[model samples]
Target: MNTPPSPLEAERTDGSSVRIGALVPLTRPGWAEAGRHLLAGLELAVREVNDTGGIVGRPLELVVRDSAADPTRAAAAVDELARLGVAAVAGEYHSVVARAAAARADALGLPFLCSSAVLDALTEQPTDWVARLAPPQSRGWQLYADFLLGAGHGRIAVAADSSVYWATGTRILRDHLAPRGGTVIELDMRALTPAAVCDELVEQGATALLLLVGYPDPAVSVVKAVRRDQRLAEVLLGAPAGQPEFAEWAALLGDDGAAVPFLRYLPERLSPLGTRVEKALRERLAEAPSFVAFEGYDTIAVLADVLRSHGTDRARTAASWASVAVDGTRGQIRFSRTPGISVWQWAWPSIQVVDRDPAEPDRFRVLHAG
Candidate 1:
């Protein structure tokens, strides 16, 4: 088998590029589509930054590394990026991978701005080295639980794979739903087939089935199985992890993918700056961009701002997280210490419960907002 290409680097013969390490999942088993959108956003922002005037007249550059959704690989990338002397590091889609990167970055005194991972405990202990743009998992998932309750879904079934991310999501949902007179039925996807999940849902008399599993594989299969089951026609399908947000989900499942409500981070209305970025991102991505893409763009935007104001020193960049106030594609972005969360976090990003319209599979319909 051919070996994977080396980490991409900017070609600046004079070596004047101010590099930021980008940790993205560009290969399979890692959500490659999300990575593409994220990299597009990062590239767009970098181009825009260079177009006007790059950081103090030096061109901003991205050193790309594929995390491949592996925690060990991500940590190693952090070590390598640090050794390469990047000013800062950004981008990661998987929470577990981000957590490892965060720990390594903190230990190495490198600043890392996390783009999309939402695990509550990003690092075992709070440190100044890491900051995140994605709202914490508890905040987003709790809002999802509230949406389910408002939609009259008290009896919920979750088909989940065993992983810290999925398990954390399950705990958040259970904790949020239990006191609100809701019942959560857990289905272990590791042992149960899609058909078996359908059987379990019926037996448990669940009104909604939440997918706490990975995309395409069992998720697509589970959606197909549920959609085809005549007895489960009225049951609501959900993916709190935002599985249906990407174009691949639609391409594979078509109309069956529609109406499966999932969480998304976007405002009901975009600001003027946001509107412009959205159009540019759409053109760059050749499709309507997911929130993850905006997160990527915003990550660069924030970093550019910090680098310009604080210079390229890693310590200054890490210290500058408390003062970030960039206008992101979603809203005004700012980072702060939130309760129970270790990383400097964007206090909140706009949260919404949305689904693809059955009539127009490509169109999304917002069901609730938080």
Candidate 2:
């Protein structure tokens, strides 16, 4: 395989054009539902760039890599993209993977911006080359906890993936809830033996449950366990990663009156930019896309602008990366002023369970801004 041009290589060449390689989970199993939204969003942004006028008179080119949600795979993808000479790159959600990708970019001195990964740790150690479009998960968790605690709830139960994302999320949730005088009961379903989660729930007598995991099976199992017991019925549900196919979750829970709320930065009610982009993407993809796909789309859209403005001066491109800002489908996204992980803005829109019928999985009313 040919190697991508290094900053030195690009420095020696003309400043007429630029290329942006986007690293994303294009073909990961169990995440296609989420990936589609990211892809759709990426394509939408690319289409917009090409349609009106190419960025800075140069068209944006998107190069894709599949991380498969594995750290090793994610690092490899970043290496490949860097080799392909992308002026700057962005990432998928799941902060662990994002951090790995950021590490790769840091080693290569390539500019990296994250659109979906929300963990605060990823951005806290920011580098010269990395930034993010969403606020850190630290902020996200604090916002979520404050909302719950402010709602007059005394007790909170957290069910999270044993995976990195959920693990990190649980830490932040604990930190946020501890000082608020709220009881935080956290359970990691990923590492537990069968029926352990159910037993734990029974033991805790939790009146409210917050889900921080995304692996569908265990999440469904937990909800089902909650539904099977009438005692858990009154528990209010909060899900940070539970919006895209909530009907499936409700069905698994037998719709037994468990109201699970999804906490996201962007609300379901599409903003003007979000609406226009969604319409354009649907026209291109021929269907409504998933949430993460839209994240990907927005990632590309803003990245294209960055490349256009810099015109292939890798160092200048990297330095000027902060200048590129647009009203994304998510919200006002700009690079972080911090050094390690650079996510500045985050919109926390709460998606709640409005109506659930197996017939309609996308049935969600924006309980709060997404």
**Highest lDDT model number:** 1
Give candidate 1's error at residue 352 in angstroms.
0.6
Q: Pick the candidate with the highest TM-score.
A: 1
Q: List the residue pairs that clash in candidate 1.
A: none
The 0-to-1 C-alpha lDDT of every candidate, in the order given, reads 0.92, 0.63
TM-score of each: 0.95, 0.82
Candidate 2 runs further than 4 Å off: 1-18, 28-30, 190-194, 243-258, 267-270, 283-291, 336-361, 368-370
Per-residue alpha-carbon lDDT of candidate 1 for residues 1-370, written as tens digits (9 for 90 to 100) = 9775322212223347789999999998999999998999999999999997888777998999999999999999999999998999999999999999999999999999999999999999989999999999999999999999999999999999999999999999999999999988999999999999999988999999999898779999999999999999999999988989999999999999999999999999988888999999999989999999999999999999998888787888889999999988888899999889999999888999999999999999999999
Q: Could you tally the backbone clashes for each prediction?
A: 0, 28
lDDT of 2 by residue, 1-370 (tens): 9999765455335444456666666564435445555656776677678777666555666776766677788788888888888877765765688878877877888877676777666644445676666666666666667767766766787776667677777777778777878788877655763267656766887777776666466566666666676666566766765443423344455554245555555565667888877777677666654456567767776666666555555576567655766666756556536533344333332323332333444454444331
lDDT score at residue 265, model 2, on the 0-100 scale: 50
